[model samples]
Target: MDKNAPKIAIVGAGVVGLTVADILQKDLNKANITVIADKFKEDTTSSVAAGIFCPGSSFRGATLEIAHRWIEDSWYYWQDILKTPEASTAGIMELSSYVFSKEDYGVTRNSFIENLVPIYRSVQGEELKICGPDWKYGSYFTTVKIGCDRYLPWVEKRFIAKGGKIVNGKIDSFTDTSLRQYDLVFNCTGLGAKYLCNDSNIFPMRGQVIRVKAPWLKTAFFGDYDTYIIPGLDGVATLGGVRQYDTYNLKVCKHDAAAILDQCSQMLPDLKKVEIVAHKVGLRPHRVPVRVEPELIGGLKVVHCYGHGGNGVMSAPGTALNAVKIGYDFLKTNVKNKI
Candidate 1:
């Protein structure tokens, strides 16, 4: 290790943190990187996400232009990886999805990804009946899904190979740490940010899903009430979910599970017969505008990059890239003066 190189610490192990670590190692190769997080792999919310690339218009930043830029940058970032040979191993796969709405036309419209994806078009008269009767409006689009089951491990492996260190520990506070020790600290602690920064704006949106062995199903489907059927690379499809606001209940709710089964069965009746693989519950760290800014905390150069809400996996890379730039600036200015 070069003693003159900057030392950086990333405080979360979810997709956001890992993605930041990945790019940082590449962008600043001489810097010493350490990932300190309490949870990793399946334990983080990044693993629980269905990992779809589509983003709702509601997912935003401080401004509309910044929000649009994040989505566009993220789309092209994943598209570049999708073309690589490691796509499958990295859990990046191209998937076509159908969104249907019986009453609200707005449910079928996605302004954020309409023009970004390769194919986005309204369904025809006969195609409306493809799922079942009572389908009024629908849209068929081609997109990509990132299965975190493989992605998290893949990224971690690459990070370690690039001389990055992984430290398993829950960060109690930012100011409590040795501020002058590291050049910069990145706060990417998803739901953990609630306590770390005492950020009242951050809240948990509980979601539950059932994974089933359904190889026959290829395309993804999204109906009302956050209900979705997303197929992964390993022939396992993720059927989900319910968005319970301000709910911290990680237990599998029987009522929510029953409703998911009923709604999903209505879309693909054959799903009722598929064997269940597993059930998962996650608390999405949601905020009004996903936070991505630099703050000086007790003389520590800290860049905040949490509050990804439900679209963490979808937009992790873009946000990570932005965080890296902020961190680099902090190191060059504030931390350099202290050191």
Candidate 2:
């Protein structure tokens, strides 16, 4: 370790923060790095996510081009992992998904990932009836699914083994005295940025999902009204969901669980008999364009990398890469205390 290595602090333990930490550790070997967060494995919104690589049409970066780059970069990052023998242990795998829409064909088409995935085309013939007579429009795409349940801990172990420090703590604000020692800070606080930076554009997009024991179900499915069925490792499939924008409620809503069950079971009758595993609610940190820029705040150099909404799990690596790049550049700039 270099005695003059840069000291860095990461503000969240979720997918984004950890991803940033992992990448930075590789980019700046021997740089002192610490991950500070109030939550850990199974507690973060990332864990509740189905971890499918399918990004919604609304998911974007600072621009359409940037957004596309993030998705493409992420695809290849996971692809590299998928090719490794540790893929299953790392909770990364290839997955095929079918999305059906009863009313509009547009709902079935995903412009964001259609060209990126290996296979993405309209469902035809008996395929329409695969999900119990969808009878309208559909598209089948082969993508990847990440199960954060295994991923978070796996990456954490790697980080710690590489001498990265993990602090089970909360950061009240960017200017909080605890951050004074670090030469650079990466603020991947997700929704917490709404208060930390008082960013009005960032808000909670509440989402809920139910995990079930459906060993027989392998492929993923999506239907109208934000309905989705995603399978993960260990025969545990995720059924979801409800997206209530600006809603901050985190408690598990019985109504949302019931609705998710009903909707998912309707698409795959076998889900009706699947054993219930757990219900999860997460407030997605949503903003039109995710924040991945740097600033000098109160003489501290920081890179903001939050507001990924529901796409954080799939897009973490790409955005983290961008954040680390910005952090490297910011590290060279002489800091001048400013508001």
Candidate 3:
């Protein structure tokens, strides 16, 4: 490492933090980037997600335009990766999805991604029967899915190739970590932010998923009760889930597994015959504004990019791109910060 090079620290190794490292490394080729996190890859909350590209209405930012920009930018980021031979290795692929509602048509609509993805249209009358006969309203659209089981390692390799470092440890606080010694730090710690920043507004949105070997299922399906069937790069498909707010239980509840299977199988009956692979639970970092800004905490310049709730995996690249922009500006102006 050069004695006077730009030293940057990024907290959290989930998709969000790693994406920050990836983008920053590309943009600031000479900067020293270190990714510190207690958990990695499959152990991360991001791994528990189906890694769908569809952003719910709840996915937000400080402003409407900012939120819109993040989603749009993120789509293109993944699209670029999807075009490469590395797409399969990177766990990035395209898949169409159907969102159905038995009661309200509004549940089937996604304003955030209507125009962003390559395809978004109301489902035909017969298409509703594709999932089940009870579905009253539905929409079909083409989207992307990322398999973090493969993505994390793929991105880490590139980050390391660019001279980035990955460290293993739990970050107790921004001021408490070795990151405080760096010129700039990006706080992408997700739910850990609740304790790391003492933020009362940010809480856990507990979610569960059941992974099953269902190769025949190519399209993703979203039904009521947070139920979804999202296919991955391999033959494995993720079926789930429930968003229990403010819960911290990491243990896999049997009740959740039963409900997820019951609901998912109801939509796609063939799922009942698939081999069960795994059950995953994640505490999504939920925040109202989806924090993505700068703070000078005890003179330690930090740019936060967490609180994507369940959308972190889907939106990491864009939020990370934005966080790097802020972090770069901080690094340029702060000449005396020490590490």
TM-score of 1: 0.97
Q: lDDT by residue for model 3 over 1-339, one digit each (tens)?
A: 566777888889999999999998887788888999999988999888889998888888999889899999999999999999999999998999999999889999999999888889998678789987888999999999988999999999999988899899988876675665688888989988888999898999999899999888889999998989999877999999999999999999999999999999999999988999998999999997899998888778889998998888889988888888888788677455542
Which residue pairs does candidate 1 place in steric collision? none
Off by over 4 Å in 2: 337-339
Models ranked on TM-score:
2, 1, 3
> Which residue runs of candidate 1 sit more than 4 Å off their true CA positions?
178-180, 335-339
Candidate 3 matches the true fold with a TM-score of 0.97
**How much does each candidate deviate from the true structure in C-alpha RMSD?**
1.4, 1.3, 1.4
Q: After superposition, how far is residue 193 of candidate 2 from its true place, in Å?
A: 0.7
Q: TM-score, each model?
A: 0.97, 0.97, 0.97
**Which pairs clash inside model 3?**
181-339
Question: What's the lDDT for residue 268 in model 3?
Answer: 90
Better of 1 and 2 by lDDT: 2
lDDT of each: 0.89, 0.90, 0.89
Q: Who wins the lDDT comparison?
A: 2
